[model samples]
Target chain A: GAGVSQSPSNKVTEKGKDVELRCDPISGHTALYWYRQSLGQGLEFLIYFQGNSAPDKSGLPSDRFSAERTGGSVSTLTIQRTQQEDSAVYLCASSPESNGFPNRGETQYFGPGTRLLVL
Target chain B: GESVGLHLPTLSVQEGDNSIINCAYSNSASDYFIWYKQESGKGPQFIIDIRSNMDKRQGQRVTVLLNKTVKHLSLQIAATQPGDSAVYFCAERGGLDMRFGAGTRLTVKP
Candidate 1:
């Protein structure tokens, strides 16, 4: 079976440029999540989408960060006006659970991640 | 801001030895905790998880112990091997958010 997949394994962009990272969740996975991992840091939650419900963007670091999942499968994370601080790996994960929230204890399968560097 | 954190930044253990990594979380409302392993140039892979109702859970060669009373969590690896070397992170689920610790680098010397 195909695991979660991300596009453009590596990307380098100017600080003020906008960049988009794509994610393809596993088949039949109802819950998809986006996370960021800075150098020498842990994974930071970014956003989550479950079924048709509204996406959770609480973990997004700033207004420059946003994501959208289309047709309940593919997700795109767009960063406006990239900053050096935004240079990190963007990872996507998906679970089979219908509700992607706490207490459910669902196992999330993660993608290889898209490494972005803001110059 | 509330956050999950680990006590140690790194741990070095000999192969065949038991390795334990500890983490501390501040979100008391969290009911589920998970352990993840991340190898270089890879995304985090789920290792195990434990719910608040249970104090401990075991996997093939891993065990997750959750101590709600102390807001602590630990992952123990039995007979650690070189392949087990990676960065380990502990995460706590709060409401709709899941917070991850800074991560502890584990090195297993063969």
Candidate 2:
């Protein structure tokens, strides 16, 4: 079975430029999540989408960060006016758990991730 | 704000030896925990997981122990091999989010 997939394995951009990272979740995976990992740091939750409901954006570091999962499958994380500090590996994952699941800890399959470097 | 943390940032073991990675979580509400391994230039791969109700779970050459009373978790790998060298992370699930620890880098020396 095909796993989650992300685009632009590596991206280098100047500060203040906007970048869009894409994620394609596995077929029938209702739960999708985005995370950021800085150099030598842990994974930082960014946003999550379940079915067609509103995405959880609580973990977004700032207002400049936003994400949208269109058609409940493909998600895109947009960082506006990117800062040098925004440089990190952007990871995407998906799970088969539905909205009615008792817990949100379902197994997550991750993509290779997009490495963004903001200069 | 809840967080998961590791006691050691790195661990080294001889090939074929056993290795243990420990993690501490602050959120008592956490009901599920997971361990992941990430190699260089790659995303994390799920290793094993355990619900709060279960104290221990086992998989091939791997074991996950969760102690909710003490908010502690550990992953043990038996007969560690060179392929086992990577960054291992522990994640605690609370509410609609899961928090991940900084991860411990394991090195299997042959």
Find the candidate with the highest TM-score and give its number. 2
Q: What would the per-residue lDDT of candidate 2 be over residues B1-36, giving only the tens digit for each residue?
A: 122343437899999999999999999999989999
Tens digits of per-residue lDDT, candidate 1, B1-110, equal: 12334343889999999999999999899988889999989888999999899999999999999889989999999999999999998888887667778788899998
Stretch of 10 with least lDDT, candidate 1 chain B: B1-10
Q: Write the per-residue lDDT of candidate 2 for residues A11-108, one digit (tens) a residue.
A: 99999999999999999888888999887789888887887564567899999998888898998999999999999999999988765672256788
Cα lDDT tens digits, model 1, A1-119, are 99999998999999999999999989988888888987776788888888644457788999999888889889899999999999999999888865444323367889999999999
For each candidate in the order shown, give its overall lDDT on alpha carbons: 0.86, 0.89
Q: What pairs collide in candidate 1?
A: none
Q: How many backbone collisions does model 2 have?
A: 0
CAPRI tier of model 1:
acceptable
RMSD of each: 2.9, 2.6
